[model samples]
Target: MPMNDADAHVAAQIRAVLAAAEAGGGVAPIVEAGDPILRQTTRPFDGQVDDAELAQLAEVMRATMLAAPGVGLAGPQVGIGLSMFVAEDPGSLDPETAEVRQRSPMPLRVVLNAEYTPATSENVAFFEGCLSIPGYQAVVARPRSIELTGVDLNGTPIAEVVAGWSARIVAHETDHLDGIMYLDKAEMRSLSTNTSVAKFWNQPSTQQAASELGFTLPSSMLL
Candidate 1:
């Protein structure tokens, strides 16, 4: 049965509180793709960062994301639609050279009421898997650069143009707040099971998938 407004609110509060109280602020279970929450837009967060409940929720989200080992996560993925998400990318890999790129690790960041726009016309494809989706991945074509704007946990304004892998993470988490999933933009033919990806398509770039699996690479991703 679908949740009513009051029931959903109560459930969200309970989840946030329980997630906050778990030892070390344990990871929350990610809501799966078919959940209504994942498909709906989130409400604005009007609560102050200093608010005890809000801070606790943030901590819980951070703990959960790191525990899941995901670079980004959205509130809806955790059964809340509070226009909140967290992201942190520890490193990057150069797809062609198989070289680890040196980039500053983003400490856990909370983006609320986030907005993103393409910073460039170029599109690139890459294999993306969502925590909610579990064991499947797909090649998604996304803008190569993005201008992201949002508020931090403390409600501080953030505005920046980001590119490369960083831009991908930003666009991804922001899309969650907008009721979009990578699958919605993914190449249908490029879908693969996680096991298949590990055995066949799990290279640094999307190029391997194009050649091995007959997936189409966005022009920007072509050599």
Candidate 2:
């Protein structure tokens, strides 16, 4: 597909950011919540960026995510309105936290044009945070499992059934492509600062947080 004017402008901006990062030997600066790019629907990953550029972008994105020490990152978070993201999890939680959150390790994955659907009726509420929205966390009820489909940088197809914390990561990152932030779906009353979360709400499950914060989780999770 040909790049429309708006997409062309975005592509230029993306290439410029990549070039600056390569020249400066620094990671891409993550854009914060108020950026218009983060609120815009992303363009599909056509050939707007060449293979070499795409590879460089991926490398830079990976480096940025690691530097941010975040489990996932999206294009919009870096000021590129493109449907792409990288995700990985070391799964280094303690046994109790791991068991309660169903968190497991995930190898680094770069997904383009991603989309997901709920794989089960069950919903889980957790204190989810985002790189774009730094310093705050909120309780969000999301499907416990999801069917994810997308393509890789090489244009290879990607399809998988993701569950547990990985599923939440997938949903969260994919939502970025559609101009959706986790805050849009979060329980407003359950919002907490990072310090507060560490001090008061750092539990394996969100049940206590929900109770004390005066918010409710999905009824499905109550069963």
Candidate 3:
């Protein structure tokens, strides 16, 4: 049965609390690194998608992302092996209106077995982070634009073009589904708090830029 309205509301409240906590303080303990599952790349669900099971997993994914205050998350990150993921582009917050609008030009896509084809010739560098490996970030080179094809939450196929930070986020989470880490593909990497990341987002490159700033970069970033 679907979650009742009251139950859903309460769950949303709890998720909001967890998200706030994660955004400010950081995530609580989850799966440990080198737990075998993290290293295993997941296979697509070959059988029919069970609506009930899909709903349950989708809820878990959303709650997990909220709890982590992340832009996107994958099933494998939560220790599941199916090809599924959740994404919410936390784009820009309208201060006066208090309305949150998606910053990415692309739609908020729920992707399954999503693949990417770069549209632009050159890639752009963006500082990326992950919930699985908290307090660490790196400058990863991602396509300026991409064409994505995947199944939606309802198992409906979709093909769309995405660009900018939105493209980066989708690709990042999709990599999780494929058992790849952002650090594995980054040009340079560091670990720090959101405060530090925001502070140094656009500063001119300097010796200071070479190392992690603001939030201390942990010697060992992975849990």
- Best candidate (score: lDDT): 2
Model 2, 51-84: lDDT tens digits are 9988888888888999987999999998898899
In the predicted model 1, the residue pairs found to clash are none
Q: 136 in model 2: Cα distance from truth in Å?
A: 0.6
Q: What lDDT does each candidate get?
A: 0.76, 0.90, 0.62
| Better candidate by TM-score, 2 or 3 | 2
Give the runs in model 1 whose Cα sits over 4 Å from its true position.
1-25, 48-50, 93-104
List, residue by residue over 66-91, the lDDT tens digit for candidate 1.
78778888888878877888888876
Instruction: Provide the lDDT at 26 for model 1.
Output: 65
C-alpha RMSD for every candidate = 4.3, 1.5, 10.3
**TM match of model 3 to true structure:** 0.69
Q: Which residue pairs in candidate 3 have backbone atoms (N, alpha carbon, C) closer than 3 angstroms, thus clashing? A: none
Q: After superposition, how far is residue 104 of candidate 3 from its true place, in Å?
A: 3.2
Work out the TM-score per prediction.
Answer: 0.85, 0.95, 0.69
Clashing pairs in 2: none
Off by over 4 Å in 2: none
Question: How does candidate 1 score on lDDT?
Answer: 0.76
